[model samples]
Target: MQLAQQRRAFIMETVRRDGAVRVAELVERLAVSDMTVRRDLDALAARGLVEKVYGGAVAAPGTRVEEPGFDAKTALAGPAKAAIAETAAALVEPGSVVAVSAGTTACAVAARLLDVPRLTVLTNSLPVAELVRSASRDRGEAAVPTLLLTGGAPTPSAALVGPLAELVISSLHVDLLILGAHGVSEEAGLTTPNLAEAQTNRTLIGAARRVAVVADHTKWGTVALSGFAPLDRIDCFVTDAGMPASGREVLADTVGELLVAGAE
Candidate 1:
């Protein structure tokens, strides 16, 4: 493996296993200079995989300790989310029914769906459904895919919850389920912070013929409060170019297909 790639893998694996690791230890273990280790940590930190501290780094909190408000997450991973959303949006063909989960990444995908013709979008995100409707109206196009918003209580993240959403998800099967996760791991699989959200994800996964998870590089390694799908359940993973080498390895070894978008 390339030295830079190896350094990233070493640091990620260390954090995944240890839950937290220091820069000095990473430098010693990877047999790289302190400067190199710090650079690796900086890269990982940029993706939100690890939290950088004085002389060390810690695993990002797995649980939904603080779900960023809708506006915050929308502006947080701007370029990466756009790349991922663009790639995912292309996968939807005309007249296809797609189930979109609730997350900032999924919200971005909804925004790009503005131009897709004749799309029936099923979603548990209030923000996404609203966006789809607004786009359809603004374009003066045929009411594209009929928008189906899963009925449920709204979470702080703008996710629709309660048994009503589950009922809506369980009743129908779709061509694709575009999902987002708090963490993706070979061991823990797809995970999320809220148990209700995880249950909702299960319903979405079960109802779709194909599952495509849209997550950025930051979601790697951190395990959330609940497990949603095993790695094998995901047919395709759409992530940005900045994903770590170790994360790519885990995804390749675990998921069926890995599409690294925004990479040269």
Candidate 2:
């Protein structure tokens, strides 16, 4: 098991650095059989970490948190994200204020908020803010949701972060924070690759009474550079049922509640 994990990690790192990996190269570098290399690549592909090509694997379509644009991310986790978002949207009551962190899954959650009237949403994601804006425009005055955006430098992921975003979040409190992450694990918790986004996410957590994180099962076991909080910090976690059984068990024990959104 340890050896498999090490090989998988090495493969991911190699792919991230080179943008792609050939089966022959990995087999030679790791001194493993061709079949072994293929098996490892298959595992990574199953987790959405790599995209298998004809003779090798390329970095998955939305593997890199710091570089994947909003459209790329939305395409990667379509059904799972929609299911998780629908489950998370149920947590918001009409007339309640909510803060959402940047992520594809969280964007889906933002999309669902349009149906709930009298909602006020605070966000650091330009895509999410615009989604709310377009929805409000379509719904007209009576049912429109109030949208507020934080000012800061925008990252490739469409998140606005830095001191300015933090300052604005610190002053306001909301009913819940619909947080997103590069990955979530028992040890690393909610984490992101960008340090500035990490700082702003911490502030968002503080500004909320209840925290509900929306992540797909693919996020399991992946750890990014900066961790914003521990597992216990979240009041609720919403994820798809596709999560590995072991991960589901561990997450349920750590989070206040683990809401599993079905795949179909």
List the global CA lDDT of all models: 0.81, 0.85
Per-model C-alpha RMSD: 11.3, 8.5
Worst 10 residues of 1 by lDDT: 60-69
Question: What digit string (tens of lDDT, one per residue) describes model 1 on residues 22-95?
Answer: 87787677777888888888876765567899989887765232356677777777899999999998888877
**What's the true lDDT of residue 152 in model 2?**
92
Model 2 agreement with the true structure over 178-222: per-residue lDDT tens digits: 999888877668877676888899999999999999999888887
Clashing pairs in 2: none
Shift of residue 10 alpha carbon in model 2, Å: 19
Candidate 2 vs. true structure, TM-score: 0.75
Best by TM-score: 2
Off by over 4 Å in 2: 1-66
